[model samples]
Target: MLNRANKLKLRDLRLIKAIAETGQLALAAERLAMTQPAASRMVSGIEQSIGAPVFERHPKGMTPTAVGKILARNAAGLLKGMDQTLADVQSAITGQSGAVRVGAVTGAAVGFVVPAIQKLKKTASGADIHVDVAPSDVLVEGLLGGEYDFVLSRIPAGTDPRQFQVRRGRVEVIRFLVRRDHPLAGPGPLKTADLAGWEWVAQGLRTPLRQAIEEAFVSRGIPLPDEIVNTSSLLVMFAYLGSTDAIAPTSREVAELVAPTSGASQLAALDLEDPIIINPYYHLISMKNQSLSPIAMQLHDLVYAALSGES
Candidate 1:
């Protein structure tokens, strides 16, 4: 009897569910596309296997016994789960549902990736997307370590270019940010030389942003700031600027994003005598041989289109 109970099939569950819903063997058989005689045989088999009478054969229709009700309830739940599982699988195949992990530098995250994600969500609402914003080196490491599906960053100088596929993105313009009440904030045409005396907030040495700032000062025959607070955290940078007269350099995109027109911003961009533009450094990159999931590929294409000004 135990072996017989273990042998119950999905079709058996469906037949029981149909019978419970319709409350008549003839009607259940019609719904299942089987003859009444065949349905009766299946019912007999189920009752025999479980060693119980599942239903009472009344003159008008069938009524479920206590055991039958239990089976019917469980069958409905199981069938509903099965149907949902099938739907999820179909959604995944169509690129409408899945997970995508993207890495980007802060500037690109603000200017490009954020907008692309907004558009993607409107169409593929079931797609799960994660965006990581960091410096170029960190983004590249995440891409290589399988932590990100793709990254918007430059390949580090010494790494093999052949290890990944790349599409060149736009150049980034760097702007100096200071507290709204800082001495330089009232600017009429301030040269790089004028910024030499104050304290400065900057990234660590050898990073691209740091290198750009150093070149900007050295090219103008000006000395670097006397005191420097080295950090990569934007929170720390903003906090430091809020209380002191220090200057922080950030991409124009990030500067504009954080400093809104509402005038509530604690930081404001310094209108420099000369604009500092970083070379076209960052790119849309992924491992050469790795294939992205359907959903990840969809998002990757969306970012690519945004880079090309197609979207």
Candidate 2:
């Protein structure tokens, strides 16, 4: 029985999959470009190899038996894996047709990762690129968890930086944002003290951005804003800003990305007397010893080159 099963061919599995999909031998045969009589003979041979009936023939069509369903399911997986193998081989040969997953903080997602993706797609159209934009901690976690081929983000505080192969990117200058029509949106440059009285849209208390803002206020001998909405979602922050007189602190890149020049933006960055820059900038990070697949490496190099200004 083992020897007979070992003799089953790819053609047999494909026929089984087609038969399961179409439900009729004649339809399956047409789909596979085989004659109906040839399909029947092949099905007979398959059943013989399994030593069990794989399908039950009815008046209208055929239905897969329990064994047939299992075989068809496995065949589908095998066929998909075979297709991906071919694609990977083509990618290795031509530098196209592979997938890469990247994680980045929102600022880097807009400033760097986006441009690199655009450039890569223009040349390697068959390459599949995925991007996740979140906070630095989230991006770092994704990078370490094997969810990303590489990430553009900071190593979270207290995390051992030596665990990753890091390439320092750019420092992110913080900016305060408000709706274009807010009271603070007028022409005069304001101090950090001026912002302390307003309702603020901020991330969680423990997030680096939030902590930085708090530290800035503390350093300048100003009380923290008494009313704060804590959230990490940009959409929520935008919605709050649109409806109320609230200030949002964000990276300068994000402020620029959402400014009126980029699109139909209702947000404007506040002109500050002193800039509040986060000390830890984002970096291009990948696992220390793990090598990326060829396609992922291609994108990794493209992003790294953009960071280094070589591209």
Candidate 3:
């Protein structure tokens, strides 16, 4: 019997990579210069070899199911290394060496990493960098897997600072929000009872941000309203905050940027009138036997610099 890892062929891996990048099968096939049928067969063979279909075709042409997305993402990393040795690809051509791979916390993407990418573009132009926005837990695991050179996260309080080479940084603050047209969007400072009546668009419970949110309600002796809408999609939450009376609380910076663009943000951040605060968002890294590519180092400095002015 072939070992599972040995079963995947180069073609299968390439197909998965293409599909992942294009977000559909036909587009991947076109990019690969293969017939759609051939592409489909290749994917099928891969699935059969692995004992599971890598993609599910839908109205969208193809969408990676949860497992498929992860496998595809992993496959790209594997392929990135292989292309250099065999074909001398540009990614490998430019580097001829290692590059920076970072896993950033969700909040850090726009507020920290994005600006860092800008800085890196100017200073370490030759250094290749890859960043993905993921929750803190996923990032920690990726760091252990050698998938991430470094990470930024909002870890639990008193969590071992040495565990992931924690970098001390301040937290990003967040608050409750509602559409500009919501009844409570008016100027009065938010009373705890005012929140009890509405549904909440909450953050990932796995995050400290959510914990702070829950604590805020609890501190007021208010029961979390039954209409809790939990999600990690900031865009979705922003859209809801703009279009409906839905209450979506978000990071102060993200809220400020979108609030003007969003009908709700123009309203107000409810003053729960409490001293509660979210956990600090810290940068986690692997310091043991660790080094960053020039680009990665630039990104690291830029991350701190960008957020230096921010909370």
Compare the candidates by lDDT and give the number of the best one. 1
Q: How accurate is candidate 1 locally (lDDT)?
A: 0.87
Question: For residue 260, what is the lDDT in candidate 1?
Answer: 58
Query: Which pairs clash inside model 3?
Result: none
For model 1, residues 1-311, the per-residue Cα lDDT tens digits are 56877878888999999999999999999999999999999999999998998888988888889999998999999999998999889878888889999999877888789988888888789998999988888888888899999999989888888989898887777888898888887747577777888998988898787889899889888898879999988899999999999998888778888875466888888757787778875899999999998889888998999886788
The positional error of residue 108 in candidate 3, measured at the CA in angstroms, is: 1.5
Prediction 2 TM-score vs. true: 0.69
Candidate 3 lDDT over residue span 42-142, tens digit each: 88877777776678888877877776787788888888888755644453444433378877766677667777777667644656678887787777777
RMSD (Å) of each candidate, 1 decimal: 2.8, 7.9, 17.3
TM-score of each: 0.87, 0.69, 0.60
Error of 3 at 254 (Å): 1.8
Q: Candidate 3: lDDT of 21?
A: 86
Q: If ranked by TM-score, best first, what sequence of candidates would result?
A: 1, 2, 3
Query: Among all windows of ten consecutive residues in candidate 1, which has the lowest summed lDDT?
Result: 185-194
Using lDDT as the yardstick, the better of models 1 and 3 is 1
In candidate 2, what are the lDDT values of residues 1-311, reduced to their tens digit?
Answer: 66877878989999999999999999999999999999999999999999988999999899999999999999999988988898778876676767889998877787778888888788788887889888888888888889999998888888889889998886567888899888888776798888978999988887767888889899999999889999888899999999999999987777888874446668888857887777666789999999888778878888889877787
